[model samples]
Target: MVIGPRQDRRPTMNDVAARAQVGLRTVSRYVNGMTNINPEMAERIRSAIEELGYRRNLAAASIRPGQTSGVIGLVIGDLANPYWAALARSVESVAAETGLLLTIASSEEDGARHDWVVERLLQQQVDMIIDVAPRTVGRSWSHWSPPLPPVVFVDRPGDLAGADTVLADNRGGTRDAVAALLAGGARRIAFVGDDRALHTMDERYEGYLLAHAQHGVVVDPTLVFETSHSSGQAVDLVARLLREGRADALFAANNRAAVGALLAFRTVGTRLPIIGFDDFEAAPLFDPPLSVVAQDVEAMGRAAVRAGLDRLQGDDGPARVQVLPTTLQLRGSERP
Candidate 1:
């Protein structure tokens, strides 16, 4: 038989994972000094290591040490946005309760910047991290693994194994809201929001599609627009949709989208029933009182902090994902 790549090359963690018949994460955990693994699984990993002559860097820094820096790093998207600012405020409150300081960084929705901020936080030796979201949760943080500190993801679910995540019931809330709006009488509701690359937007978009599926109504694909994450982008897209006269109602994915929709409608001197996700400070003051699917920003912050604390306090359990509920606050919009 021809020589296999494994036979000619230095064994790696990937090789160990295959030989041990376990996930790469399990192999990683055993090699990276996390001792909470099952004993049988541990033996398999150990056996693989010995057979492969794989050398573990005895001096490699563990993901986290027994000591803490009394600081919790917070990485969010666009701190200037009211929703994000509110989340940061709530996180600070929980951090203060535990005699910890918060180190905040705005990713500006940039993947490179998000990675840079994470590296800088590691250099500063923050106790742990709580990130709102980065580019794409499933693959964004794949670069940092073994030595990365514990992270609790908020606003979206992260793909990291054993990491805690706190999020709103995005799909469920949107489904309920859209279903209710449909039950009322509005058809041809347009979905306007951020790009689908974002996990939150993807979930909400799914909710939008599911609602249509439930109603047995075919969605006009043209009515769905995934614009850039900006007020200007939303305004332009919504204005174009308005000119087309293709929508009877609007479903805004987030607060900024909602604001843009309102502004666009005002400019045209026309109105449609609008239901948006995320509540802003001025929603109550709107002429017709904006309706929304409101997520508990404070609760999300608290849950993320709690999970981070648990990880620091020797809780080696599996990752805890908390999905808080959302309420449909109907004022005068989204009603037939």
Candidate 2:
């Protein structure tokens, strides 16, 4: 309907319901992305929203004062990243058991974007935040000050001043994999993937150094390469390293990086011993399978939720760090 000469109030759910000729519940369900609403009813709600120019009361949905609000927010670097997706599902499952609502936002791996998402969640009066922010791209938890939500850092290295963090056993895991490669008579191993700014990267690289040091081997700096974000980049970088004779064996920082290296080796008809940080779904199905240090993602998820809840329950001092153990999945990739 067109606006008349008279002043009009902002459109509410009631107005939309009236114009759509549907019950308030029907409109509410449609607006919330719930599946119960029939197609006909959803269309009617859509038309009414257009006619009445109704806007959602986001501010009202936020800020329920002086109580245990059931809402929690998650800020992830990328929704497309499988690791993040798995962790997100686990967090939601655990939170649901306690009747808390879980909402997620993606930062597209940008620090500024993550900051905006965090602020929005804060406005929504969420009890806590779980973030997958890396130390790279200038992300630091210290930037968040005053009335901050209890925050949990997962997988990525945090700002490091003091924040609750859950990470894998990087040094031990990497050291074992490198030892296996050496035992198989493979030398000239190269480390690939991830920028130097991330604590995860530092830990993995330190593991590489430790393994060689323990064996009285020296690292060739030229063999280390930082590649793209996903496994595809891993494949390309590994291919180049092999082509240039960088190393006879490779240590991939994560699953994606390992997958890339495997693909690259296959393309060049080379079967080098390879190891990765995280294991993939089709790891065992690879031509030579794939060996990896696997973190218990579900356990990590549960721990993050527990940490967040503990903070929400009024333990707001300096943050704590939690490290979880990782298991080695021995596959053909790390074998001769």
Candidate 1 all-Cα RMSD: 15.0
Q: In candidate 1, what are the lDDT values of residues 58-150, reduced to their tens digit?
A: 223323465466789999998889999999999999999999899999988877788788888888778889986776432366677566678
lDDT of 2 by residue, 210-289 (tens): 98888888888987876547778887888777788768888888777887777788888876788888865878898778
**Estimated TM-score for each candidate:** 0.78, 0.78
RMSD of each: 15.0, 7.9
Worst 10 residues of 1 by lDDT: 57-66
Off-target runs (Cα >4 Å) in candidate 2 are: 1-62, 138-145, 160-162, 316-318
**How many residue pairs clash per model?**
0, 1
lDDT value for candidate 2?
0.79
lDDT values of the candidates? 0.84, 0.79
Stretches > 4 Å off in candidate 1: 1-65, 136-142
Global CA lDDT computed for model 1: 0.84
